[model samples]
Target: MMTEQYVTTSITPLESLNSLSPYEVDQLQDASQGGLFRLFRQCSLAVLNSGSELDSTKLVLDKYAKFDIKISQKHRSVQLELVNAPATAFVNGEIITGIREHLFSVLRDLLYVGTELDRRCSGLTESEATTNMVFHILRHAGAIRPHVKPDLVVCWGGHSINRIEYDYTKKVGYEMGLRGLNICTGCGPGAMKGPMKGATISHAKQRQKEGRYVGISEPGIIAAESPNPIVNELIIMPDIEKRLEAFVRLGHGIVVFPGGAGTAEEILYILGILLHEKNHSLPFPLVLTGPAGSEEYFETVDNFIRSTLGDDAASKYQIIVDDPHEVAEVMREGLEQVTRYRKATSESFHYNWQMHIPESFQQPFEPNHENMASLKLIKDQTDFELAANLRCALSGIVAGNVKEPGIRAIEEFGAFEICGEPAIMASMDKLLGSFVEQRRMKINYKEYQPCYRLKHDAEVVEEV
Candidate 1:
């Protein structure tokens, strides 16, 4: 077998991260249990590993096991020395411009979150604290713009989408960009990259020089979904929960393309928040759309929502198929409504402060085997609460599919057991099975195995 290529380089920040304290540099060099070394290395590697096809974090880490990064104070600023790093991040023996910016962004956020925000919000309640943390992170990253209109559109979908669906995402993004809307996504390839790619073209055509292509990620899944090359603004939230919260709070609207369990988790997350009675009067616009041939995808997603969260949850989003122009038109009009509502309510255009996100939604869900099995899938609670539990289930499945810890856990044990009310389990089974059949689970999907087993009545069915 051919040996893996590598690059050794020293790089400095392209922007504001021109300096770091000696203590901060030492913290990055620390590899102890309490240090930020592992987190910083993983995130930096993910940023450098852009455009990689491998989606498993374990596989990525294994493939680049020799990769190492060191930080030191140099010329009154921070300089990173990468040893055996991925060659893709460099061009002509130098790091790519965008990748360089993203690298410093990783350093900036990790240092700020680890050393600064971790101790600031001790007096607030859990939900308030979480939101406050998100706000602080975004503000620190310069993502929050005061007096800006509602123009940022958060796009949710899978990194493992087909070419047809991917092209459709670009088209939808083009239409939206023609009308001067910005794009935000998970910062990976496929659906996340498509809209940004398309928007860049249209932005050029419209001479919109300051278009925002925000990419939000966290430590757990960043390796699996590296920030795509098109992403101009990258934010690393503390975890998946905060990542999801940041999307809803920062964007005025959302458009979901065809995707897998991760996309389902996003859909359920927003739906659960909207289903809360306090947000019933809110004007957050959500649209689920795909190409014409991808109708079955939305149908399955819609049926799953109707079956599990009921019709009220289903009413929160509109599904549009095959028409990028109509999709953009609908979103433009919906955003107008959002603008008016924010004005009438005296809410900030940059953040959705008035939207009530349940504490369950805000709290992080650890996708361990026991946690996966204990999720309440029955209708014993309100629709929004059930949605939260179901969201956790899908989130666990996503972890099992791509995350390093979850994949390692599945290997140590077995497929995660998901026991729920029969109807709910049945619907979930069908939805996941469709994802499998469509090859949406992983990039290397031919060898895909079920990471979960659904318990229905007396029989347990393993999904594959």
Candidate 2:
């Protein structure tokens, strides 16, 4: 299946930003700090590597270290010149059509965020500005369909999963698609690709013309989790926090599949927001589901939440096991309630404007060693606050596992140190240990390394 090691092609826009101004092209040519050249090159490479089986950002870069992309000011238009690109992205000698569209999409989103959105977000408070940036980015990407009803379901799970679990995800997606639900995910392989793949078959049978398979991602992680082929619309949020916000604001319901640290990070992020007293009346339907033999996986997650966040936090989401049809039915019914409530409240059907996401959740969390150690993971804070810290802890682990910079951080320092009270640390230890034991951390690798270690004082002892 391997072709040439590299190929060069000139690419123009398909349905996005047909032309960039001279200033924009100049900025892209600049390699300085504020310039877009490096970001543009990295993202464009990710798009070209969309269909690749590789998931590690480090390996992907090392395999194609010579890969490069440049912006050229063609006559009356702007186009990209890719150099030494991946061979799988080509048919015969030319670039694939879908990859061409995706390449333009990468350019479109990066440019919008770098210039237009950046300029527009200058003078507002941090909270107001974040929401505005999310709205504008999605609007520019044409992700929001004002005329559509509540049908989009955001699927979250691990990129590294067993065949049984992956097949189970597709079955659930097929059932949901037959019921007229669109799909969204973190935009990678495994569970993310499975649902869209399943939904495409049913959508074709049902003749659903506008079945959207939106893939939301950010710059820091796109290299690690390349956008899957099924994503019709791809968005690159400014950071992880905004990416998480986009999921809650854009999706009518959420489907949680079995995953590892990143999946736990997502679960904690959503629970943190939904636990906000201000969001007590929110009608968001959160469902955790999996195939047969996955009972222990869900039990660990359920127990961890119940032990830390208590019954109130556990009540926000239902655990549905083994039955794809029932999962889809429950989600369908929940979305119906969402529709009725939104209609009654006169809220926008396209986005969840009424949902209250706290500023703590809204702010981006840097996963550096200093920031990771500074997280308050104890139970002294509110449930939402503890959830936020737990989310950050898992986020750091995700970074150290697959992200290029985080791997560098670990190689330089050591495994991240996470400490908390005895009870909370025990729960964290159990959850993370299960993830590693289940081999949910990485796929096709020889072994999974411990990117993080739990630190407890003499007064608080626990296994990590």
Candidate 3:
């Protein structure tokens, strides 16, 4: 590792989260069991550490172990006192304006979700309550714009991607931007940042000053994949499930690019929701596209989906290759369908309230070793339910790859054991093996190791 550099500074917010109540300030500083201090520090460090090559949360925290942040309530507004922050976030000893904004955004969301969300979600079923909570979080962050047309497109892919694949994502995003569509992503680097970076130029060319590059992230994965520089609007949900829900509700359509485990998890999440019988006729646009050289990546993913979820689930999304203009055209046409469907159903344009998200998809999945082993990955259940379980399985693999807790768990206990139906296990093994071969697991692919192993009770297949 190179010699580390640090910066110390105080930053004041530009607008929102300028002030906080005395109780909120206390909670933020409280380092106790229910305190937000640890969460706040980790998230703040993530935004300040943007553009770093570190993709492992444990590694980032280890390097920045001395970093600390405090909320200082000034007479006029709130100021953040930073100690030993990453030097890259500053130039000539002044914090970058965008990084400063993101620091406050972290404070805003953490405070709102920790202190206010529970009371607002009272007396509702688990599913309704979660959806309501998501709405409140987005509205609080000013991400929901009423009376606007359906133009937000959620881009899901891996932060760990190759140069050619990353460039393909930018091309797709540029195409979408020229057509007046906004972008939403996981707020990380690689595939997530490429789209936003490409869209900025196109938006400027079109003179669309209000182009929204919304990034939705959660506390767990934020450190592993820091918020990219081009993300103007960042919303940090309480957990990964809520973060996924925020994307489906806030965006009109979705464009999937090449990715690894995390990307597969996102695909399963959306496909599971779309496969619901109630959502059979819903006109949500789902397109999977990449460059000409990325055919192997999509083929592996498609084969896995077909072998496991069957043909009906495979029919939910269309795959496109090497054609940015065509991808944009397809998204535009699909958005038109989305607009017509929402209007006919009398649903809000900003949020998709009419789409049915089952409780399985809404529930937060904890990807511990036990949960990973217990996932019902057999085909005995509904296709959507199977998708949900497989989503969880892939989620565990993602956690083990980068997230701090998961990384530490693997260090102590070794690789996680995933046992299930033999054929599904073989398909998963083949798909994940392809990720390893393609270098999609982490940024430092040469040093990467498998974090999970596959097994089954029945006779093992000789080939995948």
The candidate maximizing lDDT is 1
Q: Model 2: clashing residue pairs?
A: none
Per-candidate TM-score against the hidden true structure = 0.98, 0.97, 0.97
- Show model 3 residue runs off by greater than 4 Å: 1-4, 458-464
Give the residue spans of candidate 2 off by over 4 A: 458-464
Q: Pick the winner on TM-score between candidates 1 and 2.
A: 1
Candidate 2 residue 257 Cα shift, in angstroms, is 0.6
Instruction: Estimate, for each residue in 388-451, the C-alpha lDDT of model 1 and write its tens digit.
Output: 9999999999999999999999999999999988888889989999999899999886677999
Candidate 2, residue 143: the lDDT equals 92
State which candidate, 1 or 3, has the greater TM-score: 1
Best by TM-score: 1
| Order of quality (lDDT) | 1, 3, 2
Residue 14 in candidate 3 has what lDDT?
86
Query: If both were scored by lDDT, which would come out higher, candidate 1 or candidate 2?
Result: 1
Residue-level lDDT for 299 in candidate 1 = 93
Residue 267, candidate 3: C-alpha displacement in angstroms: 0.2
